[model samples]
Target: MKYVLEIENVSKFFYGLVAIDDLTIKVKPGQIYGIIGPNGAGKTTLFNCVTGIYRPEKGTIKYKGEDITGMSPHKIAQKGVLRTFQNIRLFKEMSVAENIMAGCHTKSQQKWYHSILHTPFYKKDENKYWKRVEELMEFFNLTKFAMTPTGDLSYGNQRKVEMARALAADPELLILDEPAAGLNENETIELTNIILKIKEMGLGIMMIEHDMDMVMKLTDYITVINFGKEISQGVPSFVQDDPRVVEAYIGSDDEEDEV
Candidate 1:
């Protein structure tokens, strides 16, 4: 089967420091591919390369069989690759509905002039976009907060809004960076269920998460990285048991544990 996202022998560096070292992973449609490692393990760096924030010095990234290496972030989003940051990024002052609608601009076919003149095409596009936003709100159970400013919601709700905004763009491949970073246990549980529902939508989700329980529960496959290199990758069950992954996260018994 053709993979929805492929990172083949990819590498990236900052000055002389290697950030990603010949990493390779393929994500099939509807799969939750996980990337997990200790702090400073280059997990986010790998995500940056895939999303075009940093171009790999070597190897290639393909989406739907098209090479998209080094494409601008907006161009990547236009091609249906969208992402959320490790920290929440949202329009704080915008109402819930409006923030999601911002994501639809890329999908809008109306010209700027059309919007300025209130042309028929623009009206039609607005209607279509609103319909999508409403559907997403209901899906995320955020309809009750539709008119509230995004910043007024709790952290967990803000995360939901960000995910909804990314989905509004209609991405086939979604990259999530530490999605459960600040969420409480209950919120993380809710997020997991929401992600499973997203997987049911047939979208390929590639995520970097440090929450081991969440990773083990949500991921179909996982790649464990350390010092910018992949140390192990396989089904969650296999990865969880790998000695190398164990060493990377917790270190050998000989090494003194850091406080």
Candidate 2:
């Protein structure tokens, strides 16, 4: 099976400081691939490389069999790779629907002239994108807040808006950075179920999460890293039991099970 996203022997350095050492990870269609490590473990740095914010010094990144390493961030996104930041990034003053509609711009085919003149094509495109925005709002249970400013909503709802915006771009591989960072227990549970539903859409989901319970329960496979190097990788159960992971990430067996 062709992987949805493939990173082969990839490495990134910042002024001689190793941010992401040699690493390889493949995510299949509909798979949830988790990257977990302690703070400063380079998880986000790896995300940056994959999303084209930083080009790897070595190795390659492929999406659906196409080499996309070093591609511009916008170009990568146009090619069906979209991501959310560790912190929620949304148009604070924009209505929820409008924020999601911003994402739809990537898929729009209308040119600036068409929009300026209100051409038939632009009208048609507008309808199509608005329909998509409505669908996303309902899917994320944000219909009630459709006209509300995103900043006025709770943190959890803001997160939903960001995810919905990413989905609006129609991505094949979605990269989420610390998605559950500030969510409460109940909100996190809700987000977990929402992600499982997204997996059923057959898009590969790659996430860097500090929530070990969420990682163990939600990920189809996991890569444990330490100081920019992969320490262990396997199914959740296997990685959960690996000694190296225990030493580097999960606490010792003597401690109460945290992961």
Predicted model with the maximum lDDT: 2
lDDT of 2 by residue, 86-113 (tens): 8888999999999999999987877889
TM-score of 1: 0.97
lDDT scores in order? 0.93, 0.94
Error of 2 at 193 (Å): 0.4
The collision pairs in model 2 are none
Candidate 2 least-lDDT 10 residues: 250-259
Model 1 C-alpha lDDT versus the unseen true structure: 0.93
The true-structure Cα RMSD of candidate 2 reads 3.1
Error of 1 at 228 (Å): 0.7
Off by over 4 Å in 1: 257-259
- lDDT (tens digit, per residue) of candidate 1 on 35-92: 9888998999988888888899999999999999999988999899999999999999
